[model samples]
Target chain A: MRLNLRVWRQKNGGSEGAMATYAVDGISPDMSFLEMLDTLNEDLILRGEDPVAFDHDCREGICGACSLVINGDAHGPERTTTCQLHMRSFRDGDTIDVEPWRASAFPVVKDLVVDRSAFDRVIQAGGYITATTGSAPEAHATPVPKADADSAFEHAECIGCGACVAACPNGSAMLFTSAKINHLNVLPQGSPERETRVLDMVAQMDAEGFGGCTLTGECATACPKGIPLPSIAAMNREWLRARRKVKG
Target chain B: MAVSGLIMLGYLVAHVAGNLKVFFGPEEFNAYGHWLRVMGAPVLHHHWALWIVRIVLLAVVVAHAVSAYQLSRRDLKARPTAYVHRRKRASYATRTMRWGGIILGLFIVWHLLDLTTGTLHPGGFEEGKPYQNVVDTFSTWYGNVVYIVAMLALGLHVRHGFWSAAQTLGVGNARRERLLKLLANTLALVLTAGFVSVPVAVMTGVVS
Candidate 1:
C-alpha cells in the first residue's frame, strides 16, 4: 500500500513549521500506525534525510506518549489513542495529515512532539492522596461504597494523553483535571485535602493558561478512555464549595 | 458571553421588574426609577466608582467575546480533512448559538444606548421625563414591534446561555443540570412574555 503523508516539521519550539510531504510505499495493512511510521523513518534514514520525530513508548497505548492529530481528529479518527490505531484504518492511497497538539500550554517540541509538562504540573498541584503511609491496615478498614469506588476507578482510567486538551476548543484540560480531582475526591482517603486540592488544582489550571471548559463535550468525545464530562461538573461543585469554605 | 451574560441576566431581571412598575402609572414607576439613581448616591459622589463598574462589565463582555472567538476558530480546525456525513445531533438552540449570540450582542448595545442614554430619542427626554421617552417610544407600532422582537431574541439567548454558562463553569450535576435547564427555559419564556407584553399593551393603548 502507498500512503501520502503531509507531516509537520519543526526544528524547535521557536521555529516556524510547515507540513513536508513524503510517500511511503509497501506498507502492510496489518501494520500498526506506529509501525508504518517506523517504515517511513527507515526509508528517510536510508535516503540521508532527518526522519520525522514523533513520541511513542509502550506502543501498546498505555504510556499516552504517541500523540498526534491525524487529519484533524486528535489521536486519529478513532476514539482510542494514536498507538492503538492500526494502519488498516487507512486506505491504500490515503493522504494523511499529521501534526502535533496545537495549544499554547502544550507547545510543539519538534515535529510531532509536544511539551505536555503543563499537564504534569497540574497533576503535581494536587492530583494525589495526601495520606501518609503507615503500617498496613486491613483491606476493609476504610471501606468506600461500591458505587463510589466504581466511579473513582472510571475517572482513574485517564492516561493524561493531553488528547482532551487538544480536542477542546478552548484548549481546556478540565476533563483531565476533573478526572484526577474526582479520582481522589470520591475516595475516603482523598478527603483531608479535598477542599485544598480542588482550589489548588483549579488555580494551577488557570495559571497554566489553559482556557476554561465550554462543556462542548468535544473533550470527552476525543478522550480514549471515555472520561465523562459530568466529572467536570463535579469539579466545579467542589471548587465552589472550597471557595465558600475558605471565605467563611 | 459566559460570565457577562450571567451578569446581564441578573441586570435584566432587575430592569424588567423595575419597568413593570410602569403598569402602576408614572408616579410609582418614576419613584422606583428615582430610588435606583439615589441608591448609588454614596458611590455616585466618586466619579471613578461608576466608571469602574462600567469598565468591569465592559471587561467581562470583552472576555466573553474573546473566548467565544477563540473557541469558534478551534472548532473550525477540529474537523477532519475527509468529509464524513454525520447526523445533526445538536439541539436547535445549540445549533443557532453563533448567530444568535452575534444578534443578541448587537441588540444589547442598541438597547443600552436607546434606554440608558437618550441617544435614540430625537429631541432627548424632558428633564423629569425618563418614563415619558419609554412611553413615547413604545407608543410607536414599529418601535414596539422591534423591541418585542429583540426581547424575544434575548429570551432565547438567555434560555440557552444560562445553562450553558453553568455547564461551562462546571456547576452542573445530572439532577442540577436538568433542573437548571428547566428553570432557564421557564424563566426565558416568562421574561420574554413579560417584557413583550408591556410594549404590546402600550401600543394597543391598554397601558397609559
Candidate 2:
C-alpha cells in the first residue's frame, strides 16, 4: 500500500526540526511499520538524500527501543509498540504524521529520536532489590505472596518506552516512575529499602524536571505495557506512607 | 492542591446545605444565617467563629490557587512543543480543570460581595437580614445569569476535582474506582442543583 508520510526531521540536538513530506510507493501490506520506514530509507539512500533517523532495537516490541508518535498517538493508532504496528492498519494513500516524543525532559536528539536518559537516572535513583550474590539461595527462603508476585510482574511489564511522557499533556513521568517503584516495592525481597526506594525515586523524578501527575490517564492509555492508572495511586500511597514513617 | 481542594469541597457541602434552608421560608433561613455568626455562642464570641472560618477558608483558597498556578506553569514548561497532529485527549471535565478553577475563584469574590458583605447587593444593603439580601441579589437578571453559569462551572469542577483529589490522596483504586466516580458525580449534581435552586426560586417568585 502506497502512503504519504510527514516525518519529523532534525539535524542534531541543537538544530530546529520540522515535518518533511515524502511519498513512498509499493509498500507491502504485511510489512511492519519500521520496515515500511526501511523502504523509505532505502529509496532515500538510492537518491543520496538524508534518510530519516529514529530509535529501534529489538523490533520485537519488548525492547522498548522503538519510539514514534504516529498520527498524534504514541506508537501509532495501535496499542502495541511501533515495531509491532503493521501497514495494514492504514489505508492506501493515507497521510501519516510521525514525530518524536515532545517533552522537555526528553528533548529531541535527532530526527524522531529524543534523549531518554532521564528514565535511566530515575531508575538509578532506586530500582533494585538487595540480594546475596555469593551463592544461589533457595526459592523457599524468600517466600513471596501470590498477590504480591502478581502485582510486581504486572508493573514489571513497563518497558521504559517514555510513551507515557509523550502522551501526557503535562509531560509527567509519574506513570513510568511509579511503575519502576512498584515493580520492586511490592516483593518480599524488596522490603528492605522500600521506603528509600519510593522517596529517592520520586525525588529524582521531580529533579529531572518532569511534571506532576494530574490523573489525566493519558499516560496509561498510551502505555504499550498496559500499566494501570491505579498504579500511580499505589505509588503515591507508598510515597506518603514512607514520608510518615521516615521523617526527613 | 489536593488537600486545599478537599477542604474547599467540604466547605461547599456545608454551604449548599445552608443554602437549602431558604426553602423553609425567611424565618428559618434568617435564623440559620444568624447561627452562622454565633455558631460557638458562649464558647466563642459572636462573629468570632465566623471570622475563624473565614480566615481558614482564605488561607485554603490561597494555598490552592498558588499550587495550581505553579502546577500549570510546570506543566506548560514540561511540554514545550505541541504535536502537529493533535487529537482531543481526556474527558471534557478533565481538560477544563484549570479554567474551571479560575471561574470558581472569580465567582467566590462576586458571591461574597453580593451576599456576605452585601456590597454588591442591588437593593439596600441591610445587615442581619440575609434572607432578604439573598432575594434582592437574585431578583435581577444578571445576578441569576452570572450565578447559574458559575454554578454550572462549579458542578463540572467538583465532578473532576473530587475524583482527582481521591487519586492524588492515594484513596483511589480499581476496586473503588466506580464508587469514587459515582460519589463525585452525586456531589456535583447535588451541589449544583442545591445552589441553583435558590436563584430559581427567587426568579419564579417561589420565595420572594
Candidate 3:
C-alpha cells in the first residue's frame, strides 16, 4: 500500500514544530504502525536525513511506551496501542496525521516523542500499598473480598499511557490518577493509608500541572486497555470520603 | 468541585419544582414564592431564610464558576499546540460544557434582573409579583427566546453534569452507573420540560 503521512517534527523542546509530510511506497497492510514508521525512518537514514523519533518498546502492547495520535485518535482509531495498530486500518493513498501527546505536563521531546514522566510522579504520590519486608504472608491469611479484588484488577489495567490526557480537551489526568488510586485503594492491604492515598495522589496530580477533570470521559474511550470510565467516579468518591475524614 | 456541584444540583431540582407550580395558577405559584420568603420566619426574619439560601447558592455558584474557569485555563495551558488531527469521542454535552455554562451564567443574571429585581421586566415592574413576572417575561418574544434557549442549555448541562457529579462524588459503580445515567437524563428532561412549559404556557395564553 502507498501511504502519505503528515508527522509533527520539532527540533527540541524549545523549537517550533509543524506537520511534515512523507510518502512511503510499497508498504504491507500487515505491518504494524511502528514498523511502517521504521520503513520511513530507514529511507530517511539512507539519505543522510535525521530520522523521525518516537518511543516504543515491548511492541507486544503491554509496554505503554508507544505514543502517537494517529489521524485524530490516540494510539489509533481502533482503540489499541499505536505499536499494535496495523497498517490495514488505513488504505492506499491514505494521508495519516501523527503527533506526540499534547499536554503541558508531557512536552514534546522530538518528533512524536513526549515526556510522560509526569505520570510517574502522580503514581509516586501514593500509588502503593505498604508491604512488610519479611517472609511473605500466607496467601489465605488476607481474605480479600472478591468484589474488591475484581474492582482493583479492573482499574489496574491502566497502562499509564498519556492517551487519556492527550485525548482530553482539558488535558486532565484524572483518569490515570483515578486508575492508580483505585488499583490500590480497593485492596485490603491498601486500607491503612486509603485516607492519605487519595488526598496525596490528587494533590500530586494537580501539582504536576495536569488539568482538573471536567468528566469529558474521552480518556476511558481512548484508553487502549479499556479502563472503565467509572474508575474516575470511584476516585472522586474516595477523594470525597478522604476529605471528610478530618485529619488531625 | 464535587461538593459544590451537588449543592447546585440540589438547588436546581428544587428550583425546577418551584417553577412547575406555575401551572397551578397564580394564587398557588405566588403563594409558593411568598412561602419561600417566610420559610424560617419565627426562627429568622422575613426574607432572611431566602437571603440565607441565596447566600449559600451564591457561594456555590462562585466556587463552581471559579474552579471551572481556572480548570479551563489550565487545560488550555496544558496543550500549547493543536494536534495535527483530532477526534471527539465524548458526547456533545460533555464537549459543549464550557459554552453551556457560560450561557447559563448570563441567563442567571438576566433572570435576576427580570424577576428578582424587576429591573428588566417588560410588564409592570411589580416587586414580589413572581407569577406576573413569569407571564410578562414570557409574553415578549425576546424574553421567551432568551429563556427557552437558556433552558435548553441548562438541560444539556444538567444531562452531563448530574451524572458526572454523581460519578465524581462516588455515588456510582458498574452496577449502578446505568441508573445514575438514567437519573441524569430524567432530571434534565424533566427540568427542561418544567422550565420550558412556563414560557409555552405564556405564549399560548394558558398562564396569561
Candidate 4:
C-alpha cells in the first residue's frame, strides 16, 4: 500500500516545529504504524536527509512509550497504542496526519516526542503502598476482597501513555492520576496511606499545571488500556473523602 | 464551580415551579409573586425572606462565575497549542459550556433589569404586579427572542452541567451513569419547557 504522511518535525524543544509531507510507497498491510514510519525513515537515510524523530519502545504496545496523534485521534483511528496500529486500518493511498501529544505539561522535546516526566513526578507524589524493604510476605497475610482486587487490577492496566492528556480538550491528567490512585487505593495493602495517597497525588497533579476534569470522556476514549471514564469519579470520591478525614 | 452550579440549579427548579403559576390567571399569579416577598411572613419581616434568597443566589452566581473564570483560564493555559487537524470530539452541550454559561449570565442581568427592577421593561413597568409586567415584557418581539434563546442556552448548559456536577461531587459512578444522564436530560427539558411556556402563553394571548 502507498501512503502520504504529514509528520510533525521539530529540531529541538526550543525551536519551532511544522508538518513536513512525505510519500512512502510499497508499504505492507501487516506493517505496524511504527514499522511504516521505519520504512519512511530508511528512505530518508538513503537520501542523507534527517529522519523524523518519534518515541517507541517495547513495540508490543505495553511500554507506554509510543506516543502519536494520528489524523487528530490519539493512536490514529484505532483505539490501541500507535505501535499496535497496523497499516490495514487505512486505505491504500490515504493521507495520514501525524503529530506529537499536545499539552503544556508534556512539552514537545523533538519531532514526535514530548517530555512525559511530569507523569513520573505525579507517581512519585503518591502512587505507591509504603512497606519496609524485606522478604516477600505471604499472600494469605493480606487478604483482598475479590471485588476490590478486580477493581485494582482493572485500574492497574493504565500504561501512563499520556494519550489521555493528548485527547482531553483541557489537557487534563485526571485520568492518569486517577488510574494510579485507584490501582493501589482499592487493595487492603494500600489502606495504610489511602488518605495521603489521594490528597497528595491530586495536589501534585494540580501543581503540575494539568487542567481539571470536565468529564468530557475524551481521555477514556483515547486510552489504549480501556481505563473506564468512571475511574476519574472514583478518584474524586477518594480525594474528597481524604480531604474530609485528614484536615489540613 | 460544581457547588455553585448545583445551588443555582436548585434555585432554577423553584423558579420554574413559581413561573408555572402564571397560567392560573392574574390574581393567582400575582398572589404567588407577592407570596415570594412575604414568605416566612409571621416569623420574619416583610421581603426579608426574599432578600435572603436573593443574597444567597447572588453569592452563588459570583462564586460560580469566579471559579468558571479560573478553571477556563487554567484549561486554556494547559493547552497552549491546539492540534492542527482538529476533529469534533464531545457532544454539543459539552463543547458549548463556556459560551452557554456566559449567555446565561448576561440573560440574568437583562432579566432582572426587565422585570425585577423595571429598569429595562419595554412597556411601563409596575411594581407589585409581576403578572402584567411579565406579559408586557413578552409582548415585544425582542423579549421573546432574547428569552427563548437564553432558555435554549440554559437547556444545553443544564444538560452538561448536571451530569458534570455529579461527577465533580463524586456522586456519579459507572452504575449511576445512565441514571444521572437521564436525570440531567429530564431536568434540562423540564426547565426549558416550563420557563419558555410563560412567554409562549403571553404571545398567544392566553395569559394576557
Candidate 5:
C-alpha cells in the first residue's frame, strides 16, 4: 500500500514547524503504525534527509510513549494507542494528518515528540507508597475489602499517556492525577499518607500549569486504558476530606 | 438565565411560602408581601443596584451560553464531515441541553419583562397594584397554563444544571454525585409544584 503522509516537522523545541509531506510506497498491511513510520524514516535517511523524530521505545503500546494525534483523534481514529494501530486501518493513497500531542504543559521537543516530563513531576510529588520498605508483608495481613481492592486496581491501570491532557479543552490532568490518587488511597498500604498524598499530588498537578477539570469526560473517552472519570470525583472527595482534616 | 434562573428558583420558593399565608387571611398575606418589599426594596430600590443585579445575572446567562457555544463548535470541528453512520450514547436531556438552555434563556427575558416590568401583561392588573397583579395573573386560564409549563421547564433545567455545575467545578464522587442529582430533582419538583399550585388554585377559584 502507498500512503501520503503530512507529518509535522520541527527542527527543535524553539523552531517553527510545518507539515512536510512524503510518499511512502509498498507498505505491508500487517505493519504496525510505528513500523510504517519507521519505513518512511528509513526512506528519508537513505535520501540524505533528516529522519522524522517520534517517541516510541517499547512499540507494544504499554509504555504510553507513542503519542500522536492521528486525523485529530488522540492516538488515532480507533480507541487504542498509536503503537497498537496497524497500517491496514488506512487505505492506499490516503492522506494521513499526523501531529504531536497538543497541550501547554506537553510542549513539542521535536517532530511528533512532546516533553511529557510534567507528568513525571506530578507522579514524583506523591503517586507512591511512602511507608518504610522492609520485608514484604503478608497480603492477607491488611484484609482489604474486595470492593476497595477492585477499585484500587481499576485506578492503577492508568499508564500516564498524557492523552487525557491533550484531549481536554482545559488541558487538565485531573483524570490522570485522580487515577494515581485513588489507586493508593483506596488501599490500606497507602492509608498513612492519604491526606498528604492527595494534597501533594493535586498541588503538583496545578503547579505544573495544567488547567482544572471541567468534567467534560473527554479525558476518559480519549484515554487508551479507559480510566474512569469517577476516579476524579473520588479524588475530589479525598481532597475535601484532607483539607477539612488539615483545617481541624 | 443561569444566575437569574437559579435566583428565580429561590424567589419562587419564597414567593410560594409567602402566598400560602393567604390561607391565614388578608392581613397575614399582605404583611408577608410587605416584608418582601421592605427587605428586597433596599437592595432592589436603587436603580444602580437593580441594574447591577440584572447585569450580573445577564453575565451568568452569557457565560452559560458561551460555554455551550464553544462546546458545540468543538464538536463540529472534531467531526467536520459526518460519519457514514453515527450512534449517540448521551442521554436525551444531555444531548438537548444546548437547545433547552436557549429556549429557557429566551423565556426568562420575556418572563422578567412580562411580570417584573409589566411591559407585556398577560393579565390586566391596574398599575401600582402588585397584589391585584398577582391575582389577575393567576386568574386567567391561559396565564396559569403558561406559568405551569415554564415552571416545568425550569424544573428540568435545574434537575441537570445543579449537578452538572458541581461536576464542572470538580466537587463530587460517584456516591455524592448521585446524592446531588436526587437532591436537585427533589428541589426542582418541590419548587415547581409549589409555584404551579398557586396559579392552579387561583384559576380554579379555590383561592379568591
Candidate 6:
C-alpha cells in the first residue's frame, strides 16, 4: 500500500517547525502505526537523511508514550492510542497529516517528541497520596464502598497521554487535573489530605499555563481511556467545597 | 464564574416568571411592573430595591463577561499555533458558546434600549406602560427577528451553562448527572419558549 504522510518537523524547541512530506509504499495492513513509522525511518537511514524522530515506549497501548495527531485526531481515526492503532485503518493513497501535541505547555522536543514534563509538574504539585514509605496496608483496614472504589478506579485509568489537552480548543487541562483529583479523593486512603490536595493540584494546573474548562466536553471524547466528562465537574465541586471549608 | 453565573440564572428564572404576567392582560403586567419598582416602598423608598437589584445584576454581568474574556484570552495564548487538521470532539452547545455569548450580549443591549429606555421601540414608546412597549416592540418584523434570535441563543446558553454551573459549583454527581442534564435541557426549552412566546404572540396579533 502507498501512503503519504505530512508530518511536523522541528529541529528543536527553539527552532521553527514546518510540515515535511514523505511517501512510503509496500506497507503491510497488519503493521502497527509505529512499525510503519519504523519502516519509514529505515528508508530514511539508508538514504543518509535525518530520520523522523518520534517517541514510543512499550507500544502495547498502556504506556501512553506514543503521541501523534494523525489526520487531525489525537490518535488517528480510531478512539484508541496510537500504539494500538493498526495500519489496516488506512486505505491506499491515503494522505495522513501527523503532528505533535499542540499546546504552550507541551513544547516540541523534536519531530513528534514533546516535553510532557509539564504534566509531571502538575502531578508533582499534588497527584499523590502523602503515604509514608513502608509496607503495604491491610486491604481490610480501610474499607471502601464498591461504588466509590469503582468510580475512583475509573478515573485512575488516565494514562496522562496529553490527548485531553490536545483535543481541547482552549488547551484546558481540566479533564486531566480532575481525573487525578477524583482518583484519590474518592478513595478511603486519599481522604486525609483531600481538601488541600485539590487546591494545590488546581493551583499547579493553572500555574502550568493550562486553559480553564468551559464544559466543552471534547477532552472526554478524545480520551483513549474513556474518562468521563463528569470527572471535571466532580472535581470542580470538590474544589469549591474545599475552598469554602478552608475559608471557614 | 460560578457565583456570577448562578446570580444570572436566578435573575432569568425571576424575569421569566415576571414576564409571564403579560398573559394575565395589560392590567396585571402593569401592576407587576409597579410592584417591582415599589416592592420595598416605605422601608427603602420607591425603586430603591429595584436600583439595588440593577446594580447587583450589572456587577454580576461585568464579572461574568470579564472573567470569561480573560480565560478566553489565556486559552488563545496557550495555543499560539492553530491545529493544522482540526476535528470536532466536543458538543454543539460547547462549540457555539463564544459566538452565542456575543449574540446574547448584543441582544441584551438591544433589549434594554427597546423596552427599558424606549430608544429603539418602533411604535410610540410609552414611558411607564411596560405591556404596551413590549407589544409595540414585538409588532415590528425586525423586533421579532432580533428577540427570537436572542431568546434562542439564551436557551442554548442556559442549556450548557446550567449543567456547567452545576458541575463547577459541585451540585451534581455521576448518578445525578443525567437528571441535571435533563433539567438543563428542560430549562433551556422552557425559557426559550416562554420568552419567544411574547414576540410570537404579538406577531400573530394575539397580544395587540
TM per candidate comes to 0.73, 0.98, 0.94, 0.98, 0.69, 0.96
Worst 10 residues of 5 chain B by lDDT: B78-87
Candidate 1 or 2, higher DockQ? 2
lDDT of each: 0.80, 0.93, 0.89, 0.94, 0.76, 0.88
For candidate 4, give the DockQ: 0.84
Which sections of candidate 2 miss by over 4 Å? A134-137
Which one wins by DockQ: 5 or 6? Answer: 6
**Candidate 3 Cα outliers beyond 4 Å, as residue runs:** A133-141, A246-248
lDDT winner among the candidates? Answer: 4
Residues A114-170, model 3: lDDT tens digits: 999999998888988887869988988989999888888888888898899999877
Q: What is candidate 5's lDDT per residue for B1-208, written digit by digit as tens? A: 2343456556556666776676565566666655554455655673554466567766767776776676555444433222111234234545555676777777777666666788867656454445566676776666676778777776776676666666544566666867887887888788777777777777766766
- Per-residue accuracy of model 1 over A135-220 as CA lDDT, tens digit each: 88788999999989998999999999999887775688889999999999999999999999999999898788777665667788
TM score of chain A per candidate: 0.97, 0.97, 0.97, 0.98, 0.96, 0.98
Work out the iRMS of candidate 4: 0.7
Tell me the deviation in Å of residue B150 in model 3: 0.4
Residue B22 C-alpha lDDT in model 2: 95
Residue A215, candidate 4: C-alpha displacement in angstroms: 1.2
* Share of native C-alpha contacts between chains A and B (below 8 angstroms) recovered by candidate 5: 0.15
Q: What is the Cα-based lDDT of residue B17 in candidate 2?
A: 97
* Reference A-B contact fraction recovered by candidate 2: 0.74
lDDT for residue A36 in candidate 4, whole number 0-100? 99
lDDT of 4 by residue, A1-248 (tens): 99999999999999999999999999999999999999999999999999999999999989999999999999989889999999999999999999999989999999999999999999999998888769998888888899988999999999999999999999999999999999999998788999999999999999998987888999999999999998898999998999999985
For residues B35-111, could you state the per-residue lDDT of candidate 1 as single tens digits?
66556667575345545666877787788788788877655543322222123323566656678778767876877
The residue pairs in collision within model 2 are: none
Kindly list the interface RMSD, in angstroms, of each predicted candidate in the order they appear.
5.7, 0.7, 1.4, 0.7, 6.9, 1.4
